[model samples]
Target: MTTRHDLQTRLERGIAALGLQLPAGAVERLLDYQALLARWNATYNLTAIRDPGEMVSRHLVDSLAILPYVQGATLADLGTGPGLPGIPIAIATPEREVLLVDSNGKKVRFLREAIRSLKLENVRAVQSRVEEVEGQFDCVTARAFASLADMLAWGGHLLTKSGIWLAMKGKHPEDELAGVPDGYEVRAIHELHVPDVGGERHLVVLGRTGC
Candidate 1:
């Protein structure tokens, strides 16, 4: 088993390579959060990706890829299973309020426990469908939850009139872009470079053009 210290070292290295200017003690908190996730994943199977090192790359780094594109003071991560992107963003950007939305009860339980254990004051895990989630946020994010059109259709209401949505994908979603609804437009598809990981990773930035 990889010791916690070893995982911390790898995470620190990965964070440094990623060039993220995290808040004080954010790294430690992230490690703690990862530990909790691993513990819960053993039986609950929160995520498919195992291995602490890979978690640092796939989970931590993949989530951090949107840091540069994050807009505004509040963000809602729709279909945020196990608090990907949202939880890490909350730990890194303590100023931004992050809400993780997912309908899965087990996942929500894990998210709540993670929030409590990490002592993250800025993150809240809500058990609700994306379409039913209330409030408009400055930014919204989802990870391959559904088609771009479907994603916007269901969660678009959560985004402010001029807010942005950063959708994480493993490859460029050309097919998904064909039907991006009416009010939303593709601003730019950013190709993310996550350290210690290979293959394609992109953050599709979708901005609302109308109210």
Candidate 2:
């Protein structure tokens, strides 16, 4: 079992090694997140990252790396299983509002618990399908939630006219983008380098054309 201090140290070192600067209080919030995740995962199975050390790379750092790129007012994390990038992002940018939505009751319960435990005033957990939710978010994120095209279609209506759609994908997402509906345009493709993680990670940023 890893202690909280150990996890924090690993997070600090990983962030420094990745050449990423985290927002103040991020470490503490992530620690709380890890605790809540561990507790809920006992039954809810929110995430596979049961070990604290692994949580640093798989959960904390992996989620935080995208912070520098999402410059928007309101953000939504679609299918956020146990609050991946959403909870971390909310903690990082307390001023920016975020919504974490998932269709699973268990996942949403865990997410709500995490929000309460972390005292994350900026995050709201919604237990509904992304397509059914109503809101105009400046940015909407989908992390390992669904295919690129499917996620875009489901979240398209939730984004502001000029908003961006951020999809955190694994290596080789071209297949997912191939079926994208004709409308939005791929604005940027950012390859993420997660500290101490293997394989390839990428971010696909899409933009709507005609509202």
Candidate 3:
């Protein structure tokens, strides 16, 4: 049985390995979010990963790894099932406004509950398809939600002209690079090193051409 203490230790270690300086109480808040997710996941099947330790590494730490690359004050997480990266980012940066968008009603419900329970003043959850979502953000994030081309086609309009799109992938998406739509270009590709997680992790940064 994984106690909350055990999960906290795992998360602390992972955060330390990532060299991240979270806000005071941020670590505990992250663990609280994970615990909430674990409980809800049992009934709603929000995520596939079942192990608590794995959740700390794969979900919490993996999401935080991109914190350094995250830019802008406003962000929209598209297809954010159960608020992966979005919720965690909101918790880490309380000042940044985070919008979590997902088409799944259940997931959005979970997100709302999370927001209420976590006291996340900077986060909001909406149940809507990416294409239907309104308003632009300074930064947009999509985690393994779709192919690069499809994601851009659906949610590209949400990114400001000078904003960036951070796409998380398991491995370097070399083949998908060619499919990037015109007027958008790859700014940089970073190989993220997520602590205690196996397999390759890559963050593909995209933005408007010449921006």
Candidate 4:
């Protein structure tokens, strides 16, 4: 059984390793969100990673690892299963307006509960498919949701002209690069080193052509 203190220690070390200075009390709120997810996950089966320690590393810190790449004031997380990255991002940066979209009702319900329990003022959860979601955002994030082409095809319209798309993927995704849609171009690919995570993590940054 992993204690909350143990989880906090791990999270603190991970954040320090990532070189992030999160807002005051952000760490505690992130843990609060994690605890909420764990409680709901036991009944709802929201995520496969069960152990609290692994949750601290793979879910919380793994999400925060991409914080430096995240830009703009508004962000939409498509196919945000159980609010991975989105919820943590929201907790870390309360000033950024975040929208977590997912087709799964249970996951969306859990997101709403997290927002309420965490007192997140700048977050919203919408139960909708990626293509049906409305509005434009300054940043769009998709975490291992779909291929590069398919993700842009569905959610490309949500990104503002100057906005960037942060696509999180495991491994390099070499095969998917050629499939990027016509208008969007791969701006950069960053190799992320998440503390305590055993697998390779990559963040593919995309933007409109000539932007």
Candidate 5:
């Protein structure tokens, strides 16, 4: 079992390594979110990741590794399964307004409960398909949810004219990059090295180069 102290220790190290400044008690709230997730997972099976310690690396650290790159004042995490990076991102950056979008009812409910439980004033959960969801955000993110083309097809409209699209990918998506839709261009590709996580991790950032 991943105790609170154990996760806190690991989380602190990760925050330091990543050069992230989490607000006071934000760590405890993140750990609170983790504990709540674990408790709910016992009955709902929210995620396949069972070990709490692993969640720290794969779910928490991996999700937060891109904090330095996240931009803008508003964000929409499309196809956000169990609020991978959305909830954590909101918790870490309370200044930004975060909308956690997911199609699964269970996950949506979980996100709602988490938001309420965490008392996150800047975050909200929306249950709907990404394309059908309303509102334009300054930034949009889809985490390992789908191919770059497909993700953009569904959620690109949510991004503002100058907004950025960030996608969490397992590796350098050469094929996906080749298939990027028109009007959007790949701006940057960051190779992520999540703490305690093996294997390749990359973050693909896209933006509109032309109208």
Candidate 6:
């Protein structure tokens, strides 16, 4: 059993190396989330990774890898299946309110349970599609969700005037970016380097321009 202290040390070291700051006690809550995930995964099949250590690197750490670039006040995670970047980001920024939306009932149930177990008051797990979730947000994020253009189309309305869309994608998103809707602008494209995971990861940040 990996204790919260263990995860704390790892998270602290990892974040420091990456040059980022997260709220205190994030490690404990993250560990709690991981525990809940493992327990629920048995029945729900939410995530493919089962090993705790692998979960730390692949799910927890991998998600936090984008911490260096997220800019916003309130964030909404579209298609937050099993609460990937949403849960981790919520833990990192305890002050920022985060909404995790998913259509799958089982995944939403697991997300709600994880939030409760982690005592994450800032996180709201909503069982709904991205389009159904109303209210303008400072940032909308997705991981392994949809094509870049599709993500923009579905989550566009949720963004505030200057709000951003943080879409995490694999190696080449050139084809996907070709069809981006008219009003959004590509702010930046950052490559992620997860410690042990082999593959090219890119974080595409799209901002609303008054075009």
Model 6 weakest lDDT span, ten residues long? 8-17
Give all candidates' CA lDDT scores.
Answer: 0.88, 0.84, 0.94, 0.95, 0.90, 0.85
lDDT of 4 by residue, 2-94 (tens): 889999999999999999999999989988988988899999999999999999999999999999999999999999999988999998899
Query: TM-score, each model?
Result: 0.96, 0.94, 0.99, 0.99, 0.97, 0.92
TM-score of 6: 0.92
Clashing pairs in 4: none
Give the runs in model 4 whose Cα sits over 4 Å from its true position.
Answer: none
Q: Candidate 5, residues 1-211: lDDT per residue as tens digits?
A: 5567899999888888887888888898888999999999999999999899888888888889988889999999998889989988988999999999999999999999999988999999988998899999998988989999999889888989999998999978998888888889999999998888899999999998783
Candidate 3 weakest lDDT stretch, 10 residues: 9-18
Candidate 3 TM-score to native: 0.99
Candidate 5 displacement at residue 4 in angstroms: 1.2
- Which number leads on lDDT? 4
Candidate 1 wrongly placed segments (more than 4 Å) = none
Q: List the residue pairs that clash in candidate 2.
A: none
> Mind giving the per-residue lDDT tens digits that candidate 2 earns over 57-117?
8888898888878878899999888888888888878889999999999888888878887
- Tens digits of per-residue lDDT, candidate 1, 75-121, equal 99999999988998889899999999999999999999998878888
> Which ten residues in a row are the worst by lDDT in model 5?
1-10
Task: State the displacement of the C-alpha of residue 170, model 6, in Å, after optimal TM-score superposition.
Answer: 1.5
Question: Residue by residue across 134-204, what tens digits does model 3's lDDT show?
Answer: 99999999998999999999999999999999999998999999999998999999999888999999999
**Pairs of residues at least 3 apart in sequence or in different chains that clash in candidate 3:** none
RMSD of each: 1.2, 1.5, 0.7, 0.5, 1.0, 1.8
